[model samples]
Target: MSKAKKKKKVTPNQQTSSSKWIFWVIGIIAVCILGLIVLSNMSKGGGDERAALTYDNQPYLGKESAPVEVVEFGDYKCPACKNFTESFFPLIQKDYVDTGKVKFYFMNYAFINNDSSRAAEFAETVYKELGNDTFWKFHELLYKKQNAADEKKDVLTESYLEDTLKEVSSDADAKKVASAFKDGKGKDAFDQDMKTANDLGITGTPTIYVGGKKFEGKTIDDFDQMVKDAAKENK
Candidate 1:
C-alpha cells in the first residue's frame, strides 16, 4: 500500500481504541457510585428514627445508638412482671442490648401505685449516679429480693418500698431517692407513669414489645424465644 494510505488506516484504528476506552471508564464510574449509595444507607442504621430518642424523658438504661428499642411496661408487685425483668432483661442486655443491637426504655406503669414508683426510682437514682450499668445491677437485685416485695399490700405502700431498696443498695442516695415517696414527689411521678400506662391500655404488668408487638408468655424463658422471633421480624 502507499505510505499515505497506511497512515490514514492507522488513524482510524486509534479512534476506535479511544472510543472503547471511554465506554469502559464510564461503566467503572457507574459501578462505584452505586456501591457508595448502598454503603451510605447501611451506615445510617437502615433508616430507623428511634435512634433520635436517648435515655431522656424516661428511666432508660442502655446504648442510645442501638438499632432496636425494647420498651417495657411493668408494675413491681406482679410476679410475671418480675419474671420478665429477672430472666429476659439480662439475656437481652447481653445478647442484644449491650452489643448495640437494641436499646431499652422502661416505661413505668406504676400499676401498684406509689410502691411501684419507689422501686423504679431506685433504678433511676442509680442511673443518675452510676449511669446505665449500675441501674442494671440494682434491677437484678430487686428481682432477687423478690420475696420482700412479693406481698401485695406491703409492696404497694411508700415506706415499705423504701425499706426494700435499703436492703439491696447501700448507696447513700438510696435513702434520699426513696424519701421522694413520703414527700409526695414520688407519688407525682408514679401518677404520671400510671397515666401513661392507662393511655396505652396496659392493664397488666410486664408487658413487653419488640418493634411494638407485645411478648406473650407465662414465664420469662417463654418470651426469650419471642425476642428472637421479633428481632427476625424487624429484619
Candidate 2:
C-alpha cells in the first residue's frame, strides 16, 4: 500500500501575517479613494459656502440684463489663460456674449507676479477711463501681446501698456492713463477683485463660474451647455 499523502499545513503565524498584509493593502486603497473624492468635490466648488457674488461696477462683456453670468478669475501672465483667450473665448463671445445669452466678466487674480497685478491695474484704468467697449478691446490686445512675447521675457511695461491702449482706442488718453498709472488709480478695484477671489477660495488661473456654479470642463460645448442650462433653470 502506498504511504498516505501528506498536506503541508500553513502555520498560525503565517496565516496571521497574510491576513494583516491583505488588510494593509485594502486600507491603503481606501485612503486613496477618500483623497480622490475630496479633491473632486473641492474642484467642483462643492466644499465652499456659496456667497452672494456680484459683478456690479466691474468691467464686463455682454448685456447687463443677460440671464446667465459667467465670471473668470484669471492671471495675465498665465499661459493657460492666454490659450483660453485665443482658442475658446471667440466661441464664447460669439455664442454667449454676442447673443446676449450670457454676461461675462474677467476678474484679475494676479497670482503669477507683481507685474500681473500691474497689468490688471492697467486694464482697470482703461476700463475706468475709456468705457466698456474700449476696455474689452484692450483686454483682447493684452492677451495677444502676452502670447507673442518670449517665454522668459517680461513685456508688459507701462510704456507697452500705454501703446496698447492707444492701439485699441484712438480716443484713449495716453497722458491721463500714464498719470493714473503713476497715481495707482486702479489699486482699489484690483484689491477688491483679489479679496473676492480669496473669499471664494479661488487658487488658480481661468477658474470660471457660470451662473455662480464652478465650470470644470474646458470645451466649447461644455461652456455652451452650461450657459444654456443656467438660462433654462432661471426661466
Candidate 3:
C-alpha cells in the first residue's frame, strides 16, 4: 500500500495565531461600524442646525409668550400657500395657536409676479393700519381673491384690492389701503420680510419652521407631532 501523506497538525501556538487573526478582523469591522454610526449621527445633527426664529417687526398670530413659534415663509400668490392656509392652518390654529402652545408668523417670499409684491404690500398695509385682528381677516381675503384670480386669469388690480378691502371690513380704510398700494407705503416692511426670507434660504412658499427647526412634514398629523415635540423640548 502506498504510504499516506502526513497531515500538518496545527500546534497550540498556531491555533492561537489563527484565533488572533480572526479577532483582529472582527475588531476592525466593529471599529468601522462604530465610525460609520458616529459619522451618520454627526451628519444628521449638522443638517438640523437651528434656523432663525424671529425677525425685526415681523407680524405674528398667537400668544406672544407661547412656548413654540411657527413661522411660515410664503408668497401670497402661491397656490400651495393658499392651499396650506385654507387646509392645514385652521387645524393648526385650533390645536396650537388657540391653545397657547404656539405662536405663528407669516413672512413674505413674493416671487411669482408684481402681483405677489402687490398683495404682500397690501397685507402689510392692513397689518400696520388695522392691527392683528383685521390683519388675519385680510390675510384670508387675499388668499380667497388669489384663488379667484387664478380661475379668472385676471390680474389682481388696484380696483380688485380696493373692493376686497371693502369686503373685508367696514372699518377698513380702503382708500388709504389703495393709496398705500399706489404709493408703496408698505414697501419697506415688504422688503424687510423678503430679506428675512433670503437670509433663511427659503426658496419656496409654505416653508414652515417650528422652534427654529424646518418643518419637513406634509400632513396635519406631522404638524401636530412636530408641535408636540417642540413643546416637549421647550419644557
Per-model TM against the reference: 0.58, 0.75, 0.75
- CA displacement after TM-score superposition, residue 209 of candidate 2 (Å): 0.5
Give me the overall lDDT of model 2: 0.84
Clashes of 2: 0
Tens digits of per-residue lDDT, candidate 2, 124-144, equal 888887788888888888888
lDDT of 3 by residue, 23-102 (tens): 99999999999999999998667645777555556778888889988988887788889898988899999988888999
Q: Where is model 2 poorest over a 10-residue stretch in terms of lDDT? A: 43-52
RMSD versus native structure for model 1: 14.5
Taking the tens digit of each residue's C-alpha lDDT, what string does model 1 give over 27-78?
9999999999999988765522222222345666567665566778876656
The model with the greater TM-score, 1 or 3, is 3
Show where candidate 3 strays beyond 4 Å: 1-45, 148-154
